[model samples]
Target: MPGESVEYVVVHPDTPVGPVVGLFLLARSLEDAEEIGATVCGRALRTRAELSGFLLLGCEGRLVGPYFDRLLGWAPAGRVMPRPDHDSGNPFLDF
Candidate 1:
């Protein structure tokens, strides 16, 4: 029971929207996470709270801006996948 860890709910991407389901926030920099979001076609989402981080995005050309606009108001998506080079435990990523 000691030193136990929890796993996030994992979902594999299927439909174009599938990537949105398993989004997560990085404990690190918004800048680094935003770069990854841009890679997946999502823009960085900012909030009154600590930077909400990256979002899971589909092609904006395919979906209406209003849909994403409203979604962003709610969940404010995070990184869809952690970068392989990222050190999840170290927020500063010093290691």
Candidate 2:
């Protein structure tokens, strides 16, 4: 479990065919995750030019927009991982 990672997926559901989603990769470091997220965002944009308006990659503590030229890092709000220890607002709760 030491090698495990956390993933955050962003999706847009306004596509003509269907919803388009971009995933924030989980790797060694947050920097690496940003790199991978950027790549996924690029691919999503390339796949559908219209998806530009619905793209956002979760980086650090804030969501990374596609227009960003640099990656920003911030303190995580403990909303990482999908396990019981990582509390990202109770998944079973409904507002």
Candidate 3:
């Protein structure tokens, strides 16, 4: 019926424990569904897992590891220094 739109009725009346239990059950079901989906798409899941791990491990340092420094538009602290443009007319000399 058009009048039957989703509505909340307080069945518990007092402390409302039922709705809290229902929410926890719903969360568990969603977690299980994601796990099942991951198992079904294992190869694609591995790609995501590796990417997630790379992101976590790659940024664990205070210095911000090399993998992400370029992405953030900041150069990593010195190993091979980039010469100032005025010092070396050839840009390739930075390497």
Candidate 4:
């Protein structure tokens, strides 16, 4: 949260309008995080997906969002799917 901090809470687009759930993104540039958040939220809208977190571009870590109860038939994504070029520790991700 220090070092050029940008703290924000973003709700997944799939989430219903009620008290929105939020994900936390911390970055050196608020603009950068905002851009990534917008993309993730937008993709969630189109995919109807639920994610616990996301890895930011040019960052070595990830920003975890809210967790929602899955519908009876829902299938979860890779808990910690890494980009081909990303190399970092994400405890939530299974090796």
Against the reference, the lDDT scores of all candidates come to 0.37, 0.52, 0.32, 0.44
Number of the top TM-score candidate: 2
User: Positional deviation of 64 in candidate 3, in angstroms?
Assistant: 39
Identify the runs in model 4 with alpha carbons over 4 angstroms from their true place: 1-19, 49-95
Q: Which should have the higher TM-score, number 1 or number 4?
A: 4
Q: Model 4, 77: alpha-carbon shift in Å?
A: 28
In terms of lDDT, the poorest run of 10 residues in model 3 is 18-27
Please list the residue runs of candidate 2 whose C-alpha ends up more than 4 Å from where it truly belongs after superposition.
1-8, 11-22, 52-95
Report per-prediction Cα RMSD to one decimal.
15.9, 10.2, 23.9, 14.3
* Global fold similarity of model 2 (TM-score): 0.35
Q: Please tell me which predicted candidate would have the highest lDDT against the true structure.
A: 2
Alpha-carbon error at 88 in model 1, in Å? 22
lDDT of 3 by residue, 2-95 (tens): 3222112122324533211011111134445344333333433366654343211110102234764456464455323443464566444434
Q: How accurate is candidate 2 locally (lDDT)?
A: 0.52
lDDT of 3 at 59: 9
lDDT of 2 by residue, 1-95 (tens): 23334355666779885665656444666676666656656666778867666545443434445433232233254332233334766544232
lDDT of each residue in 1-95, candidate 1, tens digit only: 12111123234657665444333333245454444434433322443243265354442212234654655544424322333433466433232
Of the candidates numbered 2 and 4, which has the greater TM-score value?
2
Residue lDDT tens for model 4, 28-81: 565666655566555555666444354332322343334423332254443232
Q: 3 or 4, which is superior by lDDT?
A: 4
